[model samples]
Target: MLVAVLATALLVGCSPRSEPAPEVDVTGGAGEEPSLEYTPPLTISEATSEVLWEGTGPELEDSGPVLLDYRLQRADDGSLVEETYSTVPKPFTLTPEVLSADLHEALDGRTVGSRLLLLLPATSDTSSFASVMVVDVRPTRAWGEPVEPREGLPAVTLAEDGEPLIETPQGDPPRSLVVQALLRGDGDQVVEGSTVTVQYTGVRWSDGSMYDSSWVQGGPESFDLGSGVLPGLAEGLLEQTVGSQVMLVIPPESGGAVGGEEDTLVLVVDILATSAPAPDALTEEG
Candidate 1:
């Protein structure tokens, strides 16, 4: 999901591929040293993106979601098309299927604080334009410390990226819900009433069976970490930091959001990103 309101698909005007690639210079733009520039060929048949500055931070992954502050301009008349410089960067998934083939190339091998210039020439299927993107490779989620199992509780394990592997333990289900952090992160803390993007999987501890998963649903989901969600999820996600993976083992009392009645509910949640509370929410509190 795009940050700063709904993901926008606004294109004021389309630039024809008839003209040569216009000269683009990001000199003194957005706190970056204005040293990067690119000029397009008069005629082109392919899409291309080049990194203006490979940020000095850790290298970013070729796959996964990435945040970017972007500025776009039409090549024909050099009119500003769109931008995210004033607001929070947008979250864009990096898979070739989620993004275009050429877009993946631009994000590939880039460092977290990198800057890039993508010049997609005219194509039979798409329009032509120049886009300047400042990539902010945020921290990836990680598995935290393991939670000690209670007597007769189900066993849980996680894959490298925080996917859970469950093995049901034989005994009566615990009477209350359980929430644990499998991994800890160093990002800003998640307080009550925050909004977040999370990757999660839900299952039944009774049979070690799967119920729902955000990963299988094509991507993680973004929502306010408040009453708008299931009781189990709302409570389970509370007070976790961004980039931390948590596990929630729920009983009937704390599992109403997921329709738990007789089954023992288990959830593995990765708190991927968090955003500030809405202005309206702040106003209401004040």
Candidate 2:
């Protein structure tokens, strides 16, 4: 869920790939530097319908969905705000229902690898007075499937019903596989527009100390499918028949948004439950 944490609310907010690696981030400071020249504000005519962005790599246009490498900053003082480098692309689907006409007008059909600065008014008194967001865009390949592994990471197989299959030896208490299925179901595995609930533990690829996990605390973690999680995990779950336990070895790139220093991330994930949204939930949105 890319939904901004507005005190206490989550927002749920795709694509294909290729090419040389993209550069990840930039460093800068808050408060203005005396000699540096800032780009002048463009007139509405100059802004046009095309979107401009900041990034390093080939510019992608008409590719399916776009992955983004970005750094948000303060416009006035040019201060660093936030940064993200992910294996998956962030989406920018625009529609009036989800975005205001002004926003759609600001970001439709923009080219990839461009850097854009969008100024937004603060929503409340406690927030900053204004915001300047810099975005770096890169489009994905249509129907973009994740890269298949040849080496580096170990792999898991899914059952006929799309649930992850656990290699097991008949034993009491099911010592090998957990009770719940991770990524199980009788339909298209890992649909883009769905929510999935599962339990998982993540370990550092290098030394194997746990960095993060929902399973250790007990209870499953639920998230919307195909929403910029590690591609391998999403794809692996899609192949399962719901209600089956599956253990997975996640390559650094496929395990989380940011690449880990370890060679691979090992996971024991159990798909605990699934819930499909109502038809209205499938509407095209920003």
Q: How many residue pairs clash in each candidate?
A: 5, 29
Each prediction's TM-score versus the true structure: 0.66, 0.32
Worst 10 residues of 2 by lDDT: 7-16
* Ten contiguous residues minimizing lDDT sum, candidate 1: 4-13
lDDT scores for all predictions? 0.58, 0.40
lDDT of 2 by residue, 103-151 (tens): 3444455554455544443333323433344455532211112234333
Compute the lDDT of residue 95 as modeled in candidate 1.
62
* Global lDDT of model 2: 0.40
Q: Mind giving the per-residue lDDT tens digits that candidate 1 earns over 21-48?
A: 4456666543333333454332333345
**lDDT of model 2 at residue 208?**
53
Q: What's model 1's overall lDDT?
A: 0.58
| Candidate 1's TM-score | 0.66
